[model samples]
Target: MVLQGLTVLNQKNYEISQSIGKNLFDNINEGGFDYVISECQTCKWQIDMSSNVTCIHPLTLLCMSMDA
Candidate 1:
């Protein structure tokens, strides 16, 4: 699956990909807005605000592991 972007915040405004569908939806539904956003190449994670824009790389969001 090709992942392009992810919105980890709002329901009315946010969006999630089918690749990360369950985890993303679960997080939003369960109020788990906190997430790690990163570029595809580096795989370097960063803590970001839910309002921020996240760009996903090809085959991105293969898995989203949550700590909280």
Candidate 2:
């Protein structure tokens, strides 16, 4: 799904995905966790290419033109 020119795929907002995108959504150290997280515990990923505008679609303002 597209959001503000970024392809963010969240379950409540995406068309082909299902997730909240984060684990332990609260401050667990303060008191306790509000809910359980069941995703992979050892998975490490990165978006080095999309760190800038490299992954933005052509329909986005950054990819659009002033005269067109």
Candidate 3:
């Protein structure tokens, strides 16, 4: 599943945003996927900031795959 522009954070509600972000991060980690691909810069930043897994941009991954 591609979550291209998943906005997990809610700037209006800090506590709720943190809770949602944590849940999302935990679920993603538990899924054991090798890569998290996203097109949105903010999404990438959020994922990276919250979890050990690094999110890669779709175009970057595509270029990498082509090279491989």
Which candidate ranks first by TM-score, i.e. highest?
Answer: 3
Which pairs clash in the backbone of model 3?
none
- 1-68 per-residue lDDT for model 3 (tens digits): 32333334455554555565777889778888887888888778877886778899999999999999
lDDT values for all models: 0.38, 0.26, 0.72
Clashing pairs in 2: none
Per lDDT, what order, best first? 3, 1, 2
Best by lDDT: 3
- In model 3, the runs with Cα more than 4 Å from the true position are 1-14
- The local lDDT score (0 to 100) that residue 52 gets in candidate 2 is 18
TM-scores for every predicted model:
0.22, 0.17, 0.70
Predictions ranked by TM-score, top down?
Answer: 3, 1, 2
C-alpha-based local distance difference test score of model 1: 0.38
lDDT of 2 by residue, 11-67 (tens): 344432113222211222333433222222221111111221122233453335555
